[model samples]
Target: MTSTHRPDLPQLMIDEAVRAALLEDWGRAGDITSQATLPAAARASAVIAARKPGVLAGAGFAESAFRLTDASLQFEPIMRDGDRLSPGDVVARIEGPARALLSAERVALNFLGHLSGIATATSSFADLIAHTKADIVCTRKTTPGLRAFEKYAVKCGGGANHRFGLDDAILIKDNHIAVAGGVVPAIEAAKAFAGHLVKIEVEVDTLDQLKEALTAGPDVVMLDNMQPDQLAQAVEIAGGKVLLEASGGIELDTVRAVAESGVDLISSGWITHSAPVLDLGLDIEIA
Candidate 1:
């Protein structure tokens, strides 16, 4: 089978996203408090410091946040995305007009903290299943507009991405089965309509469903929310006939056990949607 080369994401998209965030904060009168408090010619130097440990992502977006706010601002990244960060580590150094610094600080941290949180959360799951063949994968339960950034964080944390969107693959779920009348019919419909390039996966809730799904020959089978014993049974049934994915209610405590059940992939949504932000601070000094 042939694979398609996906182009690297455009830097312009990150720049425009940063610009939009800045616009949201700036509104009609740009940084009114900063305009009133800081001198027009005053300059400040600052260090972007971490207050918690995490695997970093979104350094480029943070730099874009400051640069898009003011062309004269100096935004430098000392650490790249995927670098492991520790408390008190300096992420970057910035020197610019004081007003610009104050105005851009929150937006920069918003991107850095949120993305780093996702990277860290993914890394935790990846670490738990490191001994197994199962790969940690993130779900589409990402922030509505930030799916690209969140998926990138998953990669940064040593996890793989499943499908970027519904357009990428055919995944027949329980809902589709309900509509189509049965697992076999759903799988058949997907195969009939999907392009040759698209691979089909089916979600099975029980061993009976798994048996039915296997007969239809999907490229992958998802064992949703099954106990370890049931998953082991599914693995035996599959016997390498197709890739198996375990998903639903996956947490750090239970992920390793699920991976040990011999599934090929483990997916979780909380890694991106519910991860707490990493604590980061920008300390400034007037110079």
Candidate 2:
């Protein structure tokens, strides 16, 4: 993770997402409570703070929510996306029209909490395998419409992204094997269809399939649901000719063993799909 250089989430990328979220929250009525109670001229200062300790992500998204809600709002960062947080640590400071701040609060925190959750979870898995050559990567099993955002969060938490979508790389899964009639044929089809720049990966469930996959000269082999010993054996069988990825039911306790088994990458869907939301809130002060 590069701390000094924060990852770039361009305005174009964030604007659409943040705008949609804000629109969802606003609906037809548009923060009726704020409109009914607070004067349009009201102004205040607030701080986005951590309610629990975790790694941070989504600084850009959170900022986008606030600014897009009301252009005059001043959002300043005290902490970057990849920074570690403790309870009471302020993530950012905002000063703006009170009603605009209030209206944008939930959308901003939602992005922060959810993305930070993924980042924190990825960090946990990354910590265990740091000593090994393996890297923790996220699967494409991400929340709909939020794949790019979630994958970016994975990077913030010190994990790598597998593929943004099916278009980037060709991963021939077991179903693909069944469709193509066999492992060799699936690999053959993928190789024939893939362009020169695209890498081909095949998912194999057993050592026998691993043997078959290697003959087709795949760039990577996903050893799905295999035990650590089996993975070690597969690594030996490949003889470093193909990159090995151990994926399936990888949790914190077993990740180290998988890493030690000499696989090059460890991927899981849990980090993106099921990670608990990081607790964060905005503390406001009226001006």
Candidate 3:
């Protein structure tokens, strides 16, 4: 399969933000322990290891953290971004002055742990539906200022991305339904207003609205909170006329069943909102 490359603007911004945060934490005085305990010329080596199984991401940013702190530091990567790692797997090896290593440790681990958590969660859902044709996707429910990095992590975990923002596609939801008076009118108005280059998707809560949305010929239809049986029936009703998306209240245990219902896409919001950070730590070797 051909891999799609997304622009790295998000990753770059995240790196800058993380570096700034590290500086904020350090202040002008720097780490007191490292400053006093270790000699100014002290050098050390260390490895960043995962304590639990997870999908790895942000190795680049993690490396950048150390480099931004002290350009003389050297980082040797054992695994690249998007690599699946088990407990005790070393992701990167670093050697630098003790003060630089100690100062950059938390900042680097924070990015790896957070991003790996998102990737791991997304990968679990993607793995659940391996036998099905439906694609696992993440919603806009992402960390503020971390959307691009989080979405990239999702992709790294084998999940696809939905529209990046309001600009990418016209998604007419329940509120739009109310504003346009009904599913048909909402879809029609959206189609009329959208440029020929844009695709329109409409969200419908019930089978009745599903019928109406189909009649209006939307490019995609989101079946919100519908049961698996209902979704199967909806898929039948759709009859391949429109792409069917199953969303809302999806958990890992229920994802495979939803995918089996023959929907074209399954979107989960929890992958970003609720995934726990993976356990990763940077241990410096005392010499």
Candidate 4:
């Protein structure tokens, strides 16, 4: 985790996302079940509690969901984003018109659980590699509409983010090398084409390619699927002149060894695209 800072999402972004989710869930008639069961004047209080242990994220989304459902809704965040959550922990308290509270429940918990899951998964990877200098990083394989949210969750779990999009950096892969004739031409072309502020990175699978790519001076070189021994050799070859990133086949069980290889960054796509949703539930308090 950033550890010193609280995790946050911009309110405007939260409101926009929650609004779309509400619209999708409500459909044409709006929460018909809640409307039929509860009187307009009826009021209720509810708590969003965790059903499993995890890190907290996306409290902003929960607040926005209830407020957007009905402005009068009182949504109090008992636990902020980046906080550690335990089973049965009360994350938030919601009190308002019964229909509004019930209507927004799913959308609120959906963001909370999904983002928290990514955070939790990231923490698992980060914890094992804490002793090493390498920083765990998340890749671009994120859910289509929720990349920013998922990446934020990664930050909360003590991991860093790679380029948010292709436009930000020049990443030369093997295919790009093939298209450009060789690593030298590809790096030279990227260097010439990219402006002063843009960074260049390239992926290499062998020590020979590493040797060839190093001559071009990329900002970072990704070592794809290299074993810890290979990575150690790559590190020695670079001699701190360029950042070395280890990617491919990284997992919780083997992350420590990868980090110990003396690489600067470990990039994994699984953290964002495949993390399980943390279990959370909203229960109305009888009063």
Candidate 5:
């Protein structure tokens, strides 16, 4: 088994939510097919293996699903979060009642596969910028309630995380700029209104606004929708006066170019919002 410690606090809450979701999925009688076809006393053991190469994540959550279904279930993780695996690599091992395993299989695989996918995608972006000082980060475009888990997966994949919510950091976007009249006014208002502890960041779509944002001296500046040449120019203009973040139009193909532009951080919303779920399965080994 992997020696990495399980995430106690967040994992416990995730377990409770997974259990509730499983309960909702399987009501009074539980999985009807397994109950009808499999004997109650039947025992099974199985291995969770990767069918493709990717980073591992959420193994604990998958184990939680099985344990929540049957406390007697024994789960041994073969890999830790952030561990890169190849096709046919075993991720985890499970031994438990056949019915319990069958009932929990989908929920378990769902969490594991979804999170692993996010981690894999995030890792790709991180790897692209490995040579640069820029850090790959995820934005607030997450799957609602699953943000915490997804962000955790991003970290596991070697990426940094942006603010968790609106409360943590002050981000002044275009709409806020429009409401406040312009970039300078928005940043000025933010600087005046924000607490001393809060770091204020403003998004700019053009070099003119970038110039204005720099004058306001916000903690961070987000360069939105700027081309690679424009980004390099913006970075040069900023001259390390404040942290520069590159956002918008980031994809697997174009990300490396963006990272090479000398920005401090590269934030992509698609890694969490649009990444496809990894293909994984839990097959029973009758014993």
Candidate 6:
């Protein structure tokens, strides 16, 4: 992932997110169960161990949760983001007041598990297409509040990020074409209104539409749900004139074929939205 470079995360955003999650979990009662069962002075050591194989992400956020719960809590990450993990691997260790450790457990694991899942899912696609020039990319279908975290995980998994939002680039989808009355009108309107730096992309469903879109001079063209042969034909049609992207119904088994069809990028929403959480558990090491 990015030549083994760790994903660069914004510390302030991570801290703010952890605090919000802690607040949501704690509520006004503030982990009443932990407070009742544990002595005020009780302390413990714990390790976050992976129960399944996956790539790691969001270790920083997990540490932030513990530190936010109790300033005295000390958390050490043994594995950095984007590292490959195996079953029973110790990702991190923590030592702190018993109440705080127990109180922060869920929020910490939630981030660790969810982000790791995104990384692992993205890696599966990236790994399959490693032999090709195609790059895997994630779509906007992300968790509402956790888009940044999820997109960061995609990078950590060797996948590129699409435009962060609609504001960053001009993408004329099918409906946009329909509303603008046709591909030419949509492209003309976008070219007229868009900023100089914004790159325009248009989606086409058939070869005729691709021909029309090519004539319109978009920076990139997306071949939506095209079969391998059709994609190869589209590649020949583009003939290195513009970037090509293949999207729709992309899964682990079919991604390699799609990539091998000579597309520049393959975008999928499943990696972020449908990935199952990587199972992880924090167990007390000592008490």
Clashing pairs in 1: none
Off by over 4 Å in 3: 1-11
TM, every model? 0.95, 0.96, 0.94, 0.97, 0.95, 0.97
C-alpha-based local distance difference test score of model 5: 0.87
- Indicate the TM-score of model 6: 0.97
Model 3 C-alpha RMSD vs. true structure (Å) is 1.9
Q: List the residue pairs that clash in candidate 4.
A: 1-158
lDDT of 2 at 237: 99
- lDDT string, candidate 5, 175-263, tens digits: 99999999999999999999999999999999999998999899999999998999999999999999999999798898889989999
What C-alpha lDDT do the candidate models reach, one value each?
Answer: 0.90, 0.93, 0.89, 0.92, 0.87, 0.93
lDDT of candidate 2 over 1-287, digit per residue (tens): 22324556778989999999999999999999999999999898999999999999999888999899899999999999899999999999999899999999999999999999999999999989989989999999999999999988998998888988989999999998998999999999888899999999999999999999999999999999999999999999999998999999999999999999999999999999999999999999654
| 1-287 per-residue lDDT for model 1 (tens digits) | 11123213579989888899999999999999999999999899999989999988888888998888889999888988888999999999999899998899999999999999998999899988889988988899999899998998888787888899999999899999999999999999899999999999999999999999999999999999999889999999999999999999999899999999999999899999998898988998544
Q: In candidate 1, residue 246 scores what lDDT?
A: 97
Can you tell me which runs of candidate 5 are displaced by over 4 Å?
1-9
Superposition-based RMSD of candidate 1 using all C-alpha atoms, in angstroms:
2.7
Candidate 4 C-alpha lDDT tens digits along 1-287: 23456556678888888999999999999999998989989999999999999998888888999999999999888998878899999999999899999999999999998999998999899889998888889989999989999999998888888999989888999999999999989999999999999999999999999999999999999999999999999999999999999999899888999999999999999999999999999998987
Question: What ranges in model 4 sit over 4 Å off?
Answer: 1-4
Model 6 stretches with alpha carbons more than 4 Å out: 1-4
lDDT for position 194 in model 4: 99
| Pairs of colliding residues, candidate 3 | none
Candidate 3 on 57-104: residue-level lDDT in tens? 888778888888899999999997778999999999999888898889
Query: What does the lDDT read for residue 37 in candidate 4?
Result: 89
For model 4, the local distance difference test gives: 0.92
**True-structure lDDT of candidate 6:** 0.93
